[model samples]
Target: MFASGLCFVGVTGIVRYLGTELPAVQSAFLRFAWGVVFLLPALIGVLRSGMPGLHLRLHLGRGVVHVAAVVCWFYAMARIPVAEVTAIGYLNPVLLTLGTVVFFGERLSLRRVLAIGVALTGALIVLRPGLREVTDGHIAQIFAAVFFAGSYLFAKRLSGIASAGQIVAMLSLVVTLALAPLAAWVWVPVSAEQIAWLAVVAACATGGHYCMSRAFAAAPIAVSQPVVFLQLIWAALLGWVAFGEAVDVFVLLGGAVIVGSVSYITWAEARQRRRVVMPEVL
Candidate 1:
């Protein structure tokens, strides 16, 4: 999971640099399309299974939302400081909980409500809306997280019916196709250097997901997820050392709060899952 965290930072760092030379939508499209190219071997068998067995609706739904998330994320990466982008990305799981309540009719328990509030409070601290004007980049990242939450919800809906590999593969392929039109519409000249960098982004992003999947399969998500906060530290450090962006103490404090809330939520969900698996004592 630590490795995964670093890989994600690498991915975002590359995206940030490459965003200077290409449109966010096109860069994102290339990332997915390149991911599909690299993942072709793993995807081949799933592809052979035909459209009916692939759960096309869920894949398409996730792909659409994921494309939006990626585009917004890329846009945010270009316009905002990497640390700010990383800090705002923490809203994903919080938003995911809200998405479940809205779309799946899940009950909003008190714990969840508080967790949501804590997370949002953290975001408020980071943004300080009254004191500072929120940039378009900040708003873009928030939107990115919302659509990412939607994508995550769709993935959950598909979990029972598909294998992990299939889920991962379908996301890349479907999202690549979904992003095609946008890429074409806003097409621009991309140099080999830019392509090489986006390729690195593809590798890091995909590799990070693979590492996280392995960690999740090895243990309950509750155990592995907390380590994800390490990414914020790494992102802050990377921003400072690599990009010369100063770390804001408030961003650190807010991110810590957000991570704490999200970590508690993960532990709670894992406990619930264990309860479902274990028989009652009577």
Candidate 2:
């Protein structure tokens, strides 16, 4: 998980360095297109083994939403400080909880409600709309979080029916295909240097997802999720040293609040699952 965080920081830093010289859609497309290269073995394995109960529609839907998320993420990273982008992204799990309740018939417990409220408050602190200028970057990242939440919800549904490798591979291919037209629409003359940097972005992102999957498979999410906060810290320091972006205490504070809220909710859910299973065992 720590490695995953570092890889994420690498991705963010490169995107920050790349700036908006390339269009967001084109940049995103290149990343995923390169991602497909790294993940080709997995894709081939799925092709050969053949998934018996594959949900093609769900994969396509997830790819569509994921394209939106990546485009927004790239757009925001180019325009905003890395730390701010990372901090705002912590809203994803909170939004995922809401999505689950609405789409999966999950009960919205009071604990969840309180957690969501606190998470939103944390977001407000980070944005502080009235206190500071909320740029298009901020709005773009928020929308990215929403789309990412939707993507995760799709993953949740697909998890029961698909292997993690299959899901990841399918997502890469589908997203690459979906992004093609959009990328072409706004495409500009990308230099070789830009392509190389985007290739780095792709490698880091793919490695990060792999590390995250291994971490989760090795330990419970409640144990691994907390380590994610380190990404915000790393992003802050990286932005400060690399880009000379000022480190905002409020961003760290708000990020902590959001991480704490999410962690508490995760713990609560884990405990609830144990309770349900204990009765069945008894």
RMSD each, Å: 1.6, 1.7
Error of 2 at 270 (Å): 1.2
Best by lDDT: 2
Clash tally for model 2: 0
Q: Pick by TM-score: which candidate is best?
A: 2
Give the per-residue lDDT digits (tens) of candidate 2, residues 1-282: 999999999999999999988999999999999989999988999878865545888898899999999999999999999999999999999999999999999999999999999999999989999999999999999999999999999999999999888899999999999999999999899899999999999999988988998999999898899999999999999999999999999999999999999999998899889888885544
Q: How close is candidate 1 to the true structure, as a TM-score?
A: 0.95
Model 1 agreement with the true structure over 152-251: per-residue lDDT tens digits: 9999989888888889999999999989999999999988988888889999998898888889889887898789888999989988998888998888
Q: How many residue pairs in model 1 have overlapping backbones?
A: 0
Cα distance off (Å), candidate 1, residue 108: 1.3
The window of 10 residues in a row where model 1 has the poorest summed lDDT is 14-23
State residue 83's C-alpha deviation in candidate 2, in Å. Answer: 0.6
Per-candidate count of clashing residue pairs (backbone under 3 Å) = 0, 0
